[model samples]
Target: MKKINQLYTGFALAMMLLMSSCVKDLDQQPYVQETSASVYAKAENYKRVMAKVYASLAVGGQEKGDGNADLSGRAANAYLRIYFNLQELPTDEAVYTWGGGDALNPLQFITWNTTDEWSAAMYYRILYTVGLCNEFLRNATDEKISKFTPAEVAEIQAQRNDVRFIRAVAWSHALDLFGIPPFVTETDPVGAFFPRQIKRPDLFSYVESELKEVAAALPSRTQAEAGRASKGAAFALLAKLYLNAEVYTGTGKYSECVAAANEVIAQGYTLEDTYSKLFNADNDKRTNEIIFAIQQDGMNTTSWGGTTYLVCGPIVGSMNATERGVQSGWSSIRTTPQFVSLFTDVTGTTDRRARFHTDGQSLDINDVTLQTDGYGLTKFTNKTDAGGNGSNYAEGLVDTDFPMLRLADVYLMYAEAVLRGGTGGTATEALGYVNQIRTRAYAGSNAGNISQGDLNLNFILAERGRELFWECTRRTDLIRFGRFTGNTYLWQWKGGVKAGTTVNPRYNVFPIPAADRAANPNLEQNKDY
Candidate 1:
């Protein structure tokens, strides 16, 4: 079933190519104006629609075009920050300081609202991708186009399922950030407008049902479907949904989390042995830790342009000395001192917390001095000096695959869920799961011996922060624990707020983009917007 989804998704890519060539005015007109009958004439045309779906996943934050500013500038700005700081700002540990014109700046203000333009852009992009998937499924069975082999047909259906999986992800993101969103499915007209904001609980139920229906039908792992959605990916996402079910839908699904996680575990996946190796550039496809990833190639005809690394790499002061020079445009997305202090010496001897710092050599964090303010994140350091210009900012591309799901996350989630009594299990088992990750980081197995009281939700949240920093999971984790709107740190937008004290429910969900409301007057702004 998972393979079927991938095949369908691949077929959608094929559809994209066909549609691109056949639709004379598609490029000239808005997507809503395009008709399904004109576009879905052939199996190949359905593939093109899938291509658009696949392409949408690639449009995350990246480095700005200019080479000398902060990496977190306008280019890296998006819904991601809303997730990242959702927890840190309201508390004392981190704040969104006012000054920069970027979206993050306004987060400091009590009256800060998500701009309509930003909200509309994300909503538009998500719907456009969903529309492509819907169109492909509608016309995929047409006999007028060249018929597909039984195997090909199965693959096409599977691909449609994968698109739904992707759609679920987009919806989940929106629901988490915006609380209630207009649920738009394929059955709705192309230009149909939805005015009501569905309640958060209702939206959560919808997503949960959608994932449950499709995940089971997904195919098992196979090399032919590598880099595409797999059964394991579906299960992993389902686990995530369950892990947060209580927060999203007012229902606890700990057993559901265990079931979903166990499905992946039973499929022969295991945590990678090393912490750093998971993101090491050379590992690529070899890292069994990854369950799903967006495949990226630096060469011609198969490139993703290294957006993740470009956006997260060090700036002018912290570049690696032996390799790429300083990145002037790099936005120093400094790791919070709180997060940086989590690492302890494995030998219980010298503090290696400095490993997160970058010396003033090049723009990469790996090459920085150990004593530097734990500001720069070393996770996505760019090593290649392959740019035409001598500066690190000019580095063309690095082939780091953006991980969507990996085994370590599964293990950790299972442990946390079990500890929370969701799986009706003991904390010892949960501790063991956490130790597996810690041991890999060379931090020893002390984490395995933690007591029940020490295994509280706060502890689990901190553990996740230490293990999953910059993996784009922190914001979600914080929000789930009710800490996203409470914690405080230096340079926080709401200055002087105490760490782990303040509370702002509005911060839990994003405002509907103003542009969306403008375009569709029926759309309502989230409360307090």
Candidate 2:
């Protein structure tokens, strides 16, 4: 089920969408058009609208290439693009060299304020998707289901459960990034209105509860479509939430983390034999490993963000753009030295996972603006495993699916939980899981294998970098390990200094966009913002 073929790119969806309002930050009050009641009167329109919700994750709007977007700004404002910026840019995993004093540029230096556009875009993108989900969920009630045949109703029920999982993912991101974000549900009215802010602890419970229900009710891992949420996705998300339960709820839930990880493992999701193929243009075929992904089609769902950014963002002056499956390179993003040092051999002679391009580039980044400063990362590309370009490679768009949750991440999370004294899994099991990942990274060899004694928290952090750097888990992993802020761990230009300096602790959580607070007085700013 390549759901990318089903993405709703119709003008009707754009006309019927009721963009969710969280205040001035979102600018969503103006998008209300046709009544959702009339739109859903057609039996097929339900799927059309649901496809729009999923498209919100991949493309910016109904049309292609940032024209008539669901949210404002360029294609860079898409959900996954801003999500990558907020998650990876502020950490040591990546560095964007096009910083002409823009909001997205300050992230590498950790100098962003409350008025940053990228953060506001992320806030609006999540809520806008939530708003669409709320509308779909509100209409998928018992009375509404009576109108459809039994088969349609059964499908609707499953899709509605999937919508809940999508919403829970948004709220979990809020719990992780923003201390308190405005909250709403299907019970709320369908149009413009102020929403009350949810406390971090309360949001955690809501996300947890929703995921639990979805984990049990949704289709099994094998039963789900390619891009749709499955039981394994819910369990994987639950495992992630539980892994960070200590940061979100002020209580260590390592035992719960291990339990959720166990459930994910029991779902029969396996690891891909080759690690590089997991992110290539043909990644959709690796559904056995990828639990859930935001699907992208170069021709159908054309956007400048999503995997398009992943493929082109790191392509530089001397690198082969055609080999990267794009016509040209953006020459914008590169890897940090600390990240390059994670692998003993930056040239990737031994570990196939170390896909770095250091031809004309230096491992050290003395000048952040120079493309030759940092090592160019070739981890993501629009090229297929069979040596062909993606569907939309001609337009510089990409067909790579962004794996939101995968078995490798869960394997690491389970190992981390076990090391933190979780009871459900043992050190021996954790060590085996870690070695499974290591052996794959080392290409079926035991060269990177580690002992049970080596399966500590610090090694887990470094191994996570080696396995999952550009996948957008670095900042969160650092936060869980108490190294995101302060003098603990410093990489290139951590605090706008070449030698790396400590940042204030308040930088941990992004400040609630100031415009949102002004529009809704009920919302309070995060501390010291």
Candidate 3:
């Protein structure tokens, strides 16, 4: 149930929703015959289109390989891969060794500009997803619902809320990653004038309001599909948005963050006893802990993105492919020395979260471009919790579903919000939540926990790194603490320097892709791009 089988055969329908990708010229479009009249004549088409919306983030295209590349950067075009590259590669937690002709090179060194291809690709990809959601919502209106049976109408209404949740997700990422993104909604006509940009504060308000509205209509965690968004999923996203409210809108909403997190926490999700099991190929079985995950299946949702790259990218040097149960070692991604040092002992640590492979690698990374310069991470693998190979895994592809949000993260958020002066929780309770995470990480070791005094902003930040490494939250966490672009904290190879240097604060938000800005004059670039 967790795996989203590419349920639709009509790839053309998926491409039809991408208004930006339909034309050769950014500002121009060739007339097409497949209008909403033909595509949306039946109500069942709603779910098929919804599949495309989720698939946009799961696989790269209609087919696995080079042909029918749905978006640009083909292999790297998948939403989570580009999102991971932009979010994780540029941060201190991870680095890619591919320096030559790599589109992601700019991100790794923080030398990105408006012309960076990955940035543009991700921007288009997210907007394309939002467009599909808009298209679905537009077709499922009250006038259209009048024709369906009452039961069908009820199902369509529930599906409409699900589409709204997906839209809220894409918009939230856009707001977080691109500052104010070009705005569009179901109310906007399909082929009218171009959409104008919305500022960050306004975008934040939209995401907040949308989540609140949809959360009420969404199914409970138990009732929803494993990959589908639900009340828990909405609560998780709301918690994350409120956690970063200050960064997005210049307002502190830590209290709201705590309340939202508590909402999810009370929704009956518990931590997995084994920390390493969360990233195994069979992670879809760990649905109790995972609120929402981008579904991936080796046999069904095959792509170079998703957990396939996530598992293979970090396996380098002497990391045996057979031992990891994957076909090959991509050997692309590895941890920075700064990140490795966060653990008490890299080699022999009781912390199960310290999942680094040090067999032929050095702990210190003298050069960021060399693969073996830093320790490889074994956090994500094609093996299962029971040390068995994953079913249907082959040729570097995997069945690992990437956890978008988990219960542990919600717990951490609650504690952090409390420390930040949120009203709903006490420091003692916050410390208890932090200890729950540590108890899992430490396993059976005597490393019991810390007192209330140790639960400060700095400790919470470091704890987040330890727990959520490689999960694409590092950049946002660092930004909220004012450590992303300043001298307050430094990682290797930041700001294009071997020894990290302070970068311009303008980099806090990525520049809008040059092509997008050139196409829509109404879209203004972020300052100092």
Candidate 4:
């Protein structure tokens, strides 16, 4: 029997939802022959539209197998796929070796320009998500609520906060990736379809405010419904934002970060004892650790992005794809030796979290085009704990939900914030939190525990990479620690050199995509391209 996760169950009927691509098109007409009045008139369809908002973050489009994408022409427009590229590729954590057609090398090599495809697609994708969320918020008016039953009204009311939370999530990504990005809300003036750009600090405050509001409104719990954003999710996002506050706003908000982490840790989520089980096909059942996730059902909600990319990207033909529960392997993603060096033992015996696949793969990435030059990753898989493939494994689609926010990340944030001079937490507590994660990694033992002297900023940074590898937090983490675009740190191909060299500091925040700039006069590129 499969677990019933209803997060995206209503997405098929959400076709009536309208969306925008960028500043020039705030109200693009629906693809279907449906007017807003005719579509949003009913109360039942509200939930379906909300489902569309959630699906916007996970799937590429409305069509099956990610065909006929929501934003067409570019297959890399999927949120997780592009987000993974921007977050992981430029840093020392991971690399993509595909050539000829896809626009991925610039990401890994740190040479992306204003017209780069991945950044452009990501810009529109985030805005598209905001567009969907705005549409949902636009229709969830009090006037519309009065037309529905009280029970239905209650549900719609709750979703309004969730929608805001989701929108805040998109905006937060903008704040983190692109220092200053165009800002839009449901309350924009009727004619002001062109959104005004917000400063990085202001956008940070806005995101913080949205998270705080939702944190108060939504329930703090052990887990949210498969794809729903909850109070814990809000707190988790808050902690993440505050942890990197100095990078986004030039202000160290470690105390605030600790407070937010405290709230999330209080939500009663325990570590899933078996680390691998937390990311398998049946991860939906591991709600104890995953605070908020984007649901993916193999049979109903099939996608080429999301965990399908994670489970298949690194598994080449030489690797046993069937054992990993997918039909084929892409061999597209691999890690540099710097990342593999974080673990004393790449094998899982000493550290169960060290799940890198090294067979038929070189430990060093001497060439950017050879996938086998870097170590393959196995952090995510399409196999269920019972040793079975996902529901649609034969088709290469998967059921592994993307864990956007989890308890372990919160723990690391809490520990980091404390070590960074946060006031609310003690050193002992920080050490305890790190050891809690270490205990899990060391397979329920204390051998991997760190002493007080070993628990420093350097150790926290490495510990974060070790624990949260392939989780899409690397670039931001490096930027915060001053290691992203300078000579302080080097990986196999950092800044496009085999030995690695310093990159221009302007590369810290990606320039606004030239396509978006050309389309909208209101938008400006980041400080430099």
Candidate 5:
């Protein structure tokens, strides 16, 4: 099921969407469109509407390339693109060099305030998706189900469960990135008073329960469709929620994290032989390893955000644009010197994962604002495994799918959980798993294998960096390890200082956007914003 093909076609019908009120933090008006009523009359139309729910993540709006957007500024309003910037730019994993004075550039230097447009865009994107899910759930109530045939009702029940999984994912991100989000649901009446904010612990419980219930209802890994939620995706998300349970809920749930990861590991998802192929144009077919992804296509689902940013953001200054499979480089996003050093082998001869373009670029970033200061990453491209420009890709656009969850991260999560004394895994078992990951990184070199004595928390952190940098896991991983903020960790230009300085712990979680707080007084800002 390539959900995008069926999903994106329903955009014209998406005109029936209810406008959310500014004061209500996503206020809903009763969906009263006659077209929507007629469309929902058929069972198959339900599936197409469900595609719109998933489409919100891949494309900004109903139409391609920015017209008729669900949110304002469809060009920069994409979920994955905004998500990547928020997650990776503030950390050592990546930095941008274009227009250092751009309002969004403050994120790279950790100087952003609550008024930042970029931060506001990220908050709105998450809530907008949540609102879409809420509408779908509202339509699937018992009242509506009573109108359908028994068979259609059953199908509705299953899709409704999948929608819950989707909702859980969005809410989990809210809980993870922001301390808490303004909460709403199908039960909330349209045009009701402003929705109150839910604290982190309560949000955690809600997300956890929803995932468990939906995981049971979803299709098994092998039977699941291409872009649909499966038991594997649910389990993977549960594992992530549990892994960061201490941070979100103030209680360590490493044991539960291990349990959830073990479920995904047992699902028979094997990784591809080459690491780079996982990010190339043909990645949609690599469903064996990718648990869930924001599917992007050069021709079918065109967008300047999402994987298009990934393909074009890093190529700058003498890096071949044609070789990168893009029309030209944006010359903006690149990795920090600290991140490049994680590979250890400057030549990239040891680890195939070190896909850096060192040509005419320096290893040290003396000036974070200069394009030539840091190494350009070539990890993501619109090329295929055979090194040909992907036949499916177009100039200035790409077919690379943005992988949101994959099997390799699950392996590392299991190891980290066990090291933290989580149940269900032994130190020896964790060592073997880490070694298995390294063997591939080193192309089966015996020297790359670690001994039992070498396995520890610090080693796991470095290994995760080596395997998962630029994948949007760096900031959360750093936070979980007590290195994201404060004096515990520092990188180039941290806290807007050249030598790097400690920032207030409040920087750990982004403040609820000022515009949202002003519009909805029921919402309280994160402390010290």
Candidate 6:
């Protein structure tokens, strides 16, 4: 099994800290010197470089608590839960007041206020990661290390394709978050800069083309490189891109999503049969369901601070041996009643929907006991006590591997894409995929009945919420449907008190962090900042 500590080490921490520091310095660093003659001098050396590129995949800027305390918190207050609040702001779901520190907090009701620092940080992290991949590709040559024979050269090229695939992931992140980003190629000069935003459709086309090229070149499997990106991972990401193509480019790529998903499904991947097994740390690297996860190790040379559970873990009604003993000042995230209502009792006994309550008890909708007006999301529940060190108070250090893609995700993407493409697939046909996951949750057999015509975009969106709760895809899904700006329950409630009931378009994009604006004068702020 791959050790997470060895993969992330102090490097992840250094990268996170440095990303927040300075962007100009990134331009000043020299690329690793390489010549056509000396590149790829050793097969093992090239392998190590490839490994480093894989390692960079785990680096992320959003703190765990940032989502729970702010994004999820804001969303819960809006009467939507599971997906991030990015969707709630525009929908009738949420509203915000202009608090001082982050104007985007309040202005989320009115406009996109993303700052340059936020954009720059995301760009910096991705570019830095892409830089590592490019460095390996640059230095990988047949002559230098002389350690590789002809066969090894073929293998190295395949590894190089994996690096390219990772770079594509970074690019996708940029596109999804920023809409249009500058596409700097490997051949671009190290410090040369470009300041134009490409159109979203144009960027999506580029990403699609790149994934196809790399996926065709990637190996089907590699035992020695188990945690690295595989052909399946490439296909999964391609499927996701295609699934969202209509949203990103205003063009439906549902057929492409099906094709890409089918490719991964053909590779013998399947959903794990148990819901809890999917989250068990010990089963992480072993689960076939996980196509690509940010490999994490709680014990080892490259230790990551546990973040997900720490941030999203339930607050104690009262502290106990099993509960993290922190005072419950910020029980930030809660499930929406809408989401909780979706869970039906398999036994057909008394409805246990009240299990979702913050008070840890069920209540009938009409019962006065439902006064907390909160839904407890058990999906990220962490029962561990805060370690004696008190580090658990901060988020982003969770030991759980943040799953980026999984086999079940691919299956559902295919099912949804096929249904939306006007292809004749039954809810029964789709149920085959959905039931595999539902059965694992022991949530009873699939409803086993849905019609293609019945499979409206909203149905698929809700299905995604049911299956991928708290997986960080909520923001994208909401935006794609134009619901991010709608006034959902949370927005209606909060807006009623704060802004006296108004809708805002700027909430679609986050405000650029203020710190970034001070750093780059050329960086224009997202409108309403």
lDDT of 3: 0.83
Tell me the deviation in Å of residue 107 in model 2. 1.4
Model 3 alpha-carbon miss at residue 195, Å: 1.0
Cα shift from native, residue 200, model 5 (Å): 0.6
Candidate 5 lDDT, 1-529, residue by residue in tens: 2445555566445444333212344567654445445666777767767877777788776666644677884225678888888899988888788635556667887777888777778888888878878888888887887888899999888889777888888898898889778999888987757889999999999999999998888998888766788999999999999999999988999999999998998899987777888999878888889998887877667677878888888987789988877778888887888888788786668888888888899877887777888888998999877777754445576878888899899989999999998998888878888887888788877678899888889988988898988888888999999998897878887887766799788878888988788889899988888
lDDT by candidate, in order shown = 0.55, 0.84, 0.83, 0.84, 0.82, 0.53
Residue 156 in model 5: lDDT: 87
- Worst 10-residue lDDT window for candidate 1 reads 62-71
In model 2, the runs with Cα more than 4 Å from the true position are: 1-3, 8-33, 74-76
| CA shift of 20, model 2, Å | 16
Model 3 spans > 4 angstroms off: 1-3, 6-34, 65-67, 74-76, 445-448
What would the per-residue lDDT of candidate 6 be over residues 49-112, giving only the tens digit for each residue?
5655665544332222222121121221211121133433333222222223333334333433
Q: Please write out the lDDT profile of model 2 over residues 1-529, one tens digit for every residue.
A: 2565664455335444433322446645665445667676766667777777777788776667655677665224678988999899888889888876555676778888888778777888888888888988999987887888888888788779888888888888888889699999999876678899999999999999999999999888888875778899999999999999999989989999999999989988888999989999999999878888888888777778888989999998599999988899989999889989899998776888899998999888998889989999999889899989998766888989899899999999999999998988999999999899989888899998988777899999999999998888998999999999998999998999877899998888888888889999889998888
lDDT, residue 163, candidate 5: 79
Q: Can you tell me which runs of candidate 4 are displaced by over 4 Å?
A: 1-5, 16-32, 190-192, 222-224
Best by lDDT: 2
For model 4, residues 370-437, the per-residue Cα lDDT tens digits are: 87888888888899888988898768889888888999999999989998999899899999989999
TM-score of candidate 1 versus the correct structure, residues matched by position: 0.77
TM-score of 6: 0.71
Cα distance off (Å), candidate 6, residue 281: 2.0
Candidate 6 ranges beyond 4 A from true positions? 1-45, 59-112, 116-120, 141-155, 221-224, 301-331, 344-357, 360-373, 381-398, 422-428, 443-455, 488-503, 510-529
